[model samples]
Target: MPYFSRLQERPKIISKLYSNVITFLTYIVTPVLLFVILFAEEIVIVLFDTSYSNIAVLIQILSVLGLLKSFSNIGGNVLIALGKFKVGFYWNLIWSLVLTLTLLVSLQYNINLTEFTLVVFFANFASFFVWHGIILKYINIPYINLTLRFSLVFVLSFLFVYLLKSFIMFWPSQWPQSIMLGTYFSLLVLVTAYFTLLLLKNQKTIIFTLWK
Candidate 1:
């Protein structure tokens, strides 16, 4: 949070910070999100056994907020630095109220956890847009570019997952083995996204730069 204050004295740092933050969120955090989303069963079963199996769904639900939470957290720091603390407070309040009301209704109606999970997702999803708007307004980030970059990472993560699935087919079907293989593939996704972005954004080829 304090690092954001230094950004005022050096306005250009905003772009750098945005770039680094997004890259970390994309290539680093995103694969973990995708992995957890896709392999919640394996993860929970392997880590905690079938006794607590119900938690897998809840974990998946909460993990959906990974990206949104990342953006909101960073935005919170930025807001505080800019002394736009009230805006952050209000947005958070709104989301909290939404979740609280929805949760109360769910409890009253005996809603399933899946339904409750969707409610949680929606609250975070909606609050993200509000925080994102603040980012565009105060942080000077262009929404178009940011959206495109995030979308690019999103697309590539799915692609990598698909490819990794094919390779994982040859591996043993044991839960522990599957988890290990999935992690290796997850790391590959990060590497592939990193280099792919470099090529797209900088027009820099890896070893293939030779014949050009």
Candidate 2:
């Protein structure tokens, strides 16, 4: 973003820019991840086989981690651009330690895939806030505002996905042959439409940001 070059001269504008970027990214990312979570079973079955369907729940858990990592990736770049390398380093260090220790403990207990992924998710989630705190010191990110935006996206996507899933459940099972396969494509199209509508609504801002 051009705003990256002007951070020192205009902190307030940069803060607003950060807010916009975060909001844009949240909208772009949350629905995709939620879709994966909701349709993981069908996704696994299609891509692999029914035997691999057992790992669908594990994929759902990891999708949450993927969301956190995406946010962290942006924050890391911002921190490096702002010359806060040490802060990023410590955040990563803590994250690594927690993840390693958890994995070690889980290994000893012979943890199942879902439980093991939950441990990994919690570790990453713990560090996610720490990274945000570091960014707040440098950029004044609107935490409350971002939280509300994220919650809205999550809730809306969940409702949208579930309602569609419920609707598809009533369809004749033999028509599609595999009910999950039908549900998968239906949800995929619905999510694509939802994302397209969001893009249209924000097209002006997106164009301005891109051209700037």
TM-score of each: 0.76, 0.81
lDDT of each: 0.69, 0.74
Q: Which regions in candidate 2 have their CA more than 4 angstroms from the true location?
A: 1-6, 173-207
Model number with the top TM-score: 2
When summed lDDT is taken over every stretch of 10 residues in candidate 1, the lowest stretch is 203-212
Residue-level lDDT tens digits of model 1 in 1-212: 66666566554565456555655566567766776776677677777788877888888888878767875677776667666789888877887888798778777877787887887788678768867876678667655776787788778776776566556666655656556755765687668676757744663222232233
Number of backbone collisions per candidate: 0, 0
For residue 12, model 1's alpha carbon misses the true position, in angstroms, by: 5.0
Model 2 residue 197 distance off true place after TM-score fit, in angstroms:
6.3
